[model samples]
Target: MLDARLKEQLRQHLDKISQPVELVATLDAGQKSRDLHALLQEIAELSERVTLRTDGDEARTPSFAIRRPGEETGVIFAGIPLGHEFTSLVLALLQVGGHPPRVSDAQAQRIRALDEDLHFETYYSLSCQNCPDVVQALNLMAVLNPRVRHVAIDGALFQEEVSAREVMSVPAVFLNGEPFDQGRMTLDQILARVDSASTARETERLNAMSAFDVLVVGGGPAGAAAAIYAARKGVRTGLAAERLGGQVLDTQGIENLISVSHTLGPKLAADLEAHVRQYDVDLMDLQRAVALVPAQDASGLHEVRFESGACLRSKSVILATGARWREMGVPGEREYRGHGVAYCPHCDGPLFKGKRVAVIGGGNSGVEAAIDLAGMAAQVTLVEFMNELRADAVLQEKLRALPNVQVIRHAQTTRVEGDGSRVTGLTYKDRDTDAVHTLSLDGIFVQIGLVPNTEWLQGGAVELSGRGEIVTNAHGMTTVPGVFAAGDVTTVPYKQIVIAMGEGARAALGAFDHLIRR
Candidate 1:
């Protein structure tokens, strides 16, 4: 089932198995089952320590389990683990076959300490770039803790289960048969949700840290650049962020980055983190800053507080909290977020295959989404609040060539329509005629724009614009002395990745200058 290049790569990866591994499949006479069996057979042939069997009794057909020789339970795949999840399958094999994981010793110990019996099931689509992180994280937890069991299910393959569960989004996770979360999450985020004591422990650890020369408050491209530049100055630097990748993790394609021909968002985020790690910066992930307290004097240290009640102090701070996807504020939008309303087209598009959907925007993102969805969705309706589309001419031309797309301009989305479990349609009003209309659809993709992550800074020490963005000077220094801001959170004109990096470097240098001349 795998090609020559893939087979060679699989062989090399499987060679790391230090213990015997068994693949047990519960399959039927279907073509998918046959293909899965062939794939397993080929995988088994790659290493002497790997073997395949057909004795699995899982309730789902075409499902398989990767386990040790004598173990009764391990990581399971309810469908073909190809595409984005292929790496998840490989990691499951290596972890189950006595290969050590790359997690920290503390993290491994915490996973082992989870004594309760927990079962997790994650629903994913093959085209989703964000599902692998969640799948691999749960698999690693299962391998580390025997009581933790996880299964990655393909939502496209089992439509019945998806319909029954009302799963309208990719990377939907369930714990103990109840909905847990329905978006991209890191391993630390998952642990923080499951383990109640994790927050207290982390807060205590962070509170004990000493003051830093430079502390960055985000982990997107801007925050990463600031930390790297500050650490390279031979000063103590610390970076705390909700996640290392930030909003970039939700992006799909990124071709405008100068010097790099083409790359994915996750790959670029990883490279940024790796490059930052090459320095002496203290990196902390999954940390959400809730409040910023500026110093009263130049010699006093500024304090940044977290939602977990943890606080870290620094001589000079760089604010690069970045931004998040803006949501349509219509009724039923929040009630059916995962049930039908989605903000990411790349992550949740495949779930609406062969179904009618609507794209709520007219910019480049919306036009590009319409073009991409025309291939899988039965029909795509592009709704715009303006009189005309603002996408590039090339993208508009491409969108016009799609046969199944319908564009409606000067239409404002009023309300989302759902049948309690899933979306059935939507309501919009025509701007020019003030006429109301509704269209039947299975999903709604919102690609409007971004809102800065500066709600915590409101009514605080820093000066903010009317739109809530941080106000900064030419040197990237904010109204508060020794506190600088950059990227989408500030009064920046553009929100490109390259612009964010340059602003971060400028802010870092500004902080250094402030420290020396004080």
Candidate 2:
């Protein structure tokens, strides 16, 4: 049964509906279905604009939808909109009843200008806060454009579709059967990608390009250096990357670039891009390498195909594919990722100002993150699984010097606790004593390790480490004759901007060596 007081509040919200909406509920005669039906009946009675209709069809049982009077299509509600997802139903009603969104005028214009017929199929979980952002953004786009349609699928209700799409997280948006986004994103970011992917991320047949001397597969410091080194020899060099900055964009400040006292990630990214443009490197930005086809013809040109169906051939491929942050793999971690549990301290740290937070891991990065968070959050708790902190002694001392910081060693994070909307705290257990404790905090930052982006390189038969990092030798040479890897993506020890840049130079020189001899 609905809470009496809470039901009154929802009833008042439903009373203000501007248009007639049909709550077409299809529920079985089962006990659980009966409870939902009774709730819907009670909800409908409170609002004159809403009408309830129940269908006891066995196949349609447990499925329902909200349809406007003049609309042929409506938002489907496969699962019960309880708990956090109750707000989704509330917003859906408001938007369908002709309420204007709070989007900027510029964004509205961009959305309205989308004249092509598009359908967005977004999969979401009930507890995920980030999922609502994506769902609302796409719904707003559909509301603004007549040519757009949206179907929000609850992952729990549509298990078959989720499995078929290989969806591992919430807010997995699919446009035209292609995965548009795998995680949380802002509307502006979504629009920007749409602009970039208008001609890219396509699956149509691509015209093969002529052969190139060097092909750099990443766009980080390493890949940029590889391109510069290859082009310095006056050879035809090409670079393909999904993003210009690789993982550098997530970095807030760069103090170790040498000669540069202080610079931001975007600034360094722009500089690297401008530097690459000064040369004759074939820059294929926003293009992902999906597969690497072995040389088929006598031209000795290996092929690198992109998700956009565009294929480029090169005599040599230098893989500087970067890495992504390793996850905590705890319950509620993925669901409340953007909501309160974050991996990027620089990106999401500001949101926790004046709040209490926790940082996982005791390495150099983790200690630095704790120090960073101590400035923003009222108090910072640094948790490490090891008995002793792994960070340098100086860094550990610096972190301990903070008044608002606490260090907890030999602690293992057990679960992320939340109120179904946002994270509220984190629970951990002592490794030695097996005693559990919960810290009441607003956010948790996981700063453990990094996993290389070598999944795409698997198709090319590139040798990889047990951790999935591309394995390379001293000269950055892979097992394949014309293949090489560098940067955090490789099995190189101590990943740093300087180390990556040097590796990229070596890989290019190796490729140059392979070419001059051939």
Candidate 3:
């Protein structure tokens, strides 16, 4: 038992302190744990000025009201509260210690009135700066609403969870156990979505239309190529895309694309769009194809339906949708993207000149970016989740030779750390030793693999390979008559932009042949 005088002294000392102090205790079975708890309780009782709470088995605390003595508010966190976790604890304490961060009056009201419980799980890699703003927005929401529980898992730290969730992109936000948003989203946009989700009617439906000579689905490289070719060939082409430029728009440069030595993705896409405009192709920007109806007309035309209640009739169809980048799927990754996180080194690397940066993955793209950025950035850290880099030996030699480059093998990105505005560093865990370490950097580049954009066409008329690529014959003819596929979407064995364009040109010719034969 502690003496009354000692207990009183502890209480007096606690009352004098304004800031919150988090007590982090590691779980150990052999140690005298009961004594620690007893001391904590004694301190809590003697000092009416302090609040003491225990982390439960689940490492989470239930939402409860907390009022601190001599303070206007109180904050609570149920965790070990070490390393990066310590920062979160301090922020919570500050908020509860009568200096809560201010939000817009309207945002505060929206948060206060929210009665529903919202759980947000954001998957991210530390290398992606674009992820942080979304994470900040969600974190702000969590701060505003007690009903909102937000947990950021470093995708690299929790690979199994990431794979299970099928998260293939950084800044992927899951709301109420389902993916709600991906990439950077504004706070107002998120709030609007939450509001809409609460008040919107479920049965709301739009009118449908059916009828085109060519229905080009997707808006990426292949799709755009097909649209341009088909429209130029005098076909009534209707091109639908969720976003113009597809995956290529997110890319930084087109060095590998023939004829374009070092053009930006947006610029390349703009040129392609200009080419498409020269013809009479009907381009549907920000439109998604929800379904494909088989050929209903006697002339073998296919009916393609869009989510916007718009439809087009076409005798021939081309699937040109490209692929998507695979994600690191770590927590705090989605929330911190764009703020301090990033993916495309070519696009954002120059912005971080003479600054520290890290590249995740060991493929050709990853190695290439590291080598390229080594000349510009102050430091380049290359992390390969695998035991060795899969890049070509020449590139590997180049990366190894770079003085500024440091390679971390058998490591995976776990989390990204930053202010609400920009990325500052990243965390990683060793796959073999399970040792976790944080590396300070200004940027992160994800060079993971890509998944083909074929999920929408599953079980459709188009024949797909085991890897989800569209199966095409030598002439680019799909299994369905009058339908052709090209670019990376087809099983062409090569994913080069030149190959895709060549395939697109071939598909256009094949479509013409089908039209004439019919």
**Model 1 lDDT tens row, 1-518:** 89999999999998899999999999999999999999999999999999999999987888999988889555999999999999999999998988899898988999999989889999999889899999999999999999999999999999899989999998999999999998888888899889989889889999999999999999999999999989989989999999998888998889999999889888889899999999999898888899998898878999999988889999999999999888999999999999899988888888889999999999999999999989989999999999999999999999999999999999999999999888999999999999999999999999998999999898678999988899999999999999999899998998999999999999999999988888
Best by TM-score, which number? 1
Better of 2 and 3 by lDDT: 2
Model 2 spans > 4 angstroms off = 1-197, 200-206, 296-299
| lDDT tens per residue, model 2, 1-518 | 57889789888777667878777777766765777688778778877888888852323347666668656343555566664457767777777666666677977988888768777777776645456657777777776776777777666665666545655456678887787776665566677666654454233323445788899999999999999999999999998888877877667678998889988665687689889999998777667778877665435888888877788888988998899899889898988875678876654564566789999999989999999888878999999999999999999889878999999999999999988777899999999999999999888899998989888877647878888988888778888778888899998999999899999999999999988877
Model 3 C-alpha lDDT per residue in residues 1-518, reported as the tens digit of each score? 45788666545545654655433332234223455455545655654444665542323222222334433222332222222233333344344443555466866777667788888877655444444445556666665676876665445444456556655456578888887987755565577578764222211221222446777777777777787777777867777776666676666557888766787665676577678777887766645677666685547668666655556667888877778776778876777675446677644554566779999889998999899889879999999989999999999988888899999999978888876556778999999999999999877877887777777688666889998889999888888888888888778987877787788778877887788788
What are the per-model numbers of colliding residue pairs? 0, 0, 36
Q: Using TM-score as the measure, name the better of candidate 1 and candidate 2.
A: 1
Candidate 1 C-alpha error for residue 114, in Å = 0.9
Residue 337 local lDDT, model 3: 70
Per-model TM-score versus the true fold: 0.98, 0.64, 0.55
**Whole-model lDDT, model 3:** 0.67
